[model samples]
Target: MIATSEISPIATLSMQISAVLVWLGLVFLTSNILHRFKQDPELVRKVVHIGTGNVLLIAWWLHFPTWLCVSAGVTFSAIALASHYISVLPMLNDVGRKTYGIFYYALSITILVALLWDRFPEYAVIGVMVMSWGDGMAALIGKRFGKHTFVHMGNKRSLEGSFAMFVTSAIVMVIILVLANGFRFRDLGVVIPVAAIAAILEAFSPGGTDNISVPLSSAFLSYLLESTL
Candidate 1:
């Protein structure tokens, strides 16, 4: 509710073109890689879930509003969170290769609705975008070259990777905030507290699903910051 003015239709439309480009690049590349590994159709759908979903979902932020943006975001995450506790969690113990992405399908649908709603679509888009790029890159880079991990169980995540994601996400958030004139670096005394919250949200998310939390939380936090400042 802090800064819900609509961005220029042309400018907003521009992110859509980029969204398509992101989709094409992610699909072709991920599909080719999965083919090399001989992944099955189910597995392929899952991969598409992350690579394709991340970009497309994030790209939706080009539009800005109040209810539409926040609702789509809230519902998407609520579904995902629901599925996790109800449908997905029960199956987690089954122990299979393609186990992770199904519950996310529910989450994705919820987020998709959140993104399209006219009232707050822009905020939804920004949150989704940050989670997409920030969380996705963290996983990719961590797997490839994560020498120093912070946690043990998923030694999969690393300090270096998290730092990368935190910085990348915050910088983007700053841009979103800046152009809107909603808030500025100068206003928040120390932006790290806010930025750190964003980073930690992604770092601790289930299966890189911070795509749901990061933006919604950040938007709310940013809104809080806007008023307090």
Candidate 2:
């Protein structure tokens, strides 16, 4: 892996610019296209949710500097916050809905990148992917196929949704572990517990805070468990 410092100034700038373009293109174009088609706003939200999270893959592949990732997170968190009031990302925030999922999502990314990018980026990937795939799929599946329901902290959730979260979290954890440590059955010790914890957190967290709780817990727990192995 080429160190970020060794890359020439022009190359670094180019990469940063490319990152910005990709992110903006994804957000703006998706919102506009979904709006134009008059698709379900929820669909637009989920598409953006899953799509934007893939930027982490880009960051990981490109070896984005910690500051760049953190700055993007902070910037988007601010945008998400502003979007709560103004109609600034209509596809993301539903009108008159009290949910800060988008904000928490960005903040979690910021926190994970700041904490783990330098020494353990794979953990950061595990964290964000769990949130991106796990929670995103849980919401989608819950909305579509959530037949059995229960309420927690005044928030209703479906068993199907929770199961989706757990399964996705486990799959994400396993994939990252396999990529990072090769195929090892012992990693199941890490994947199972961490995925269960992620599911628990997602089920209990109310008002979309699961975005923060799920990823941070999954990543850090994975880190701790892997250390023991």
lDDT of 2 by residue, 30-111 (tens): 7779878988776777778877787886687678878888888899889888877887876676534578888889899999
Shift of residue 118 alpha carbon in model 2, Å: 0.4
TM-score of 1: 0.56
Tell me the TM-score of model 2.
0.91
Instruction: Report residue 35 deviation for candidate 2 (angstroms).
Output: 2.8
lDDT of 1 by residue, 114-172 (tens): 54444444344445556655666666666567798776335346877788777766666
Task: For candidate 1, give the lDDT.
Answer: 0.54
Best by TM-score: 2
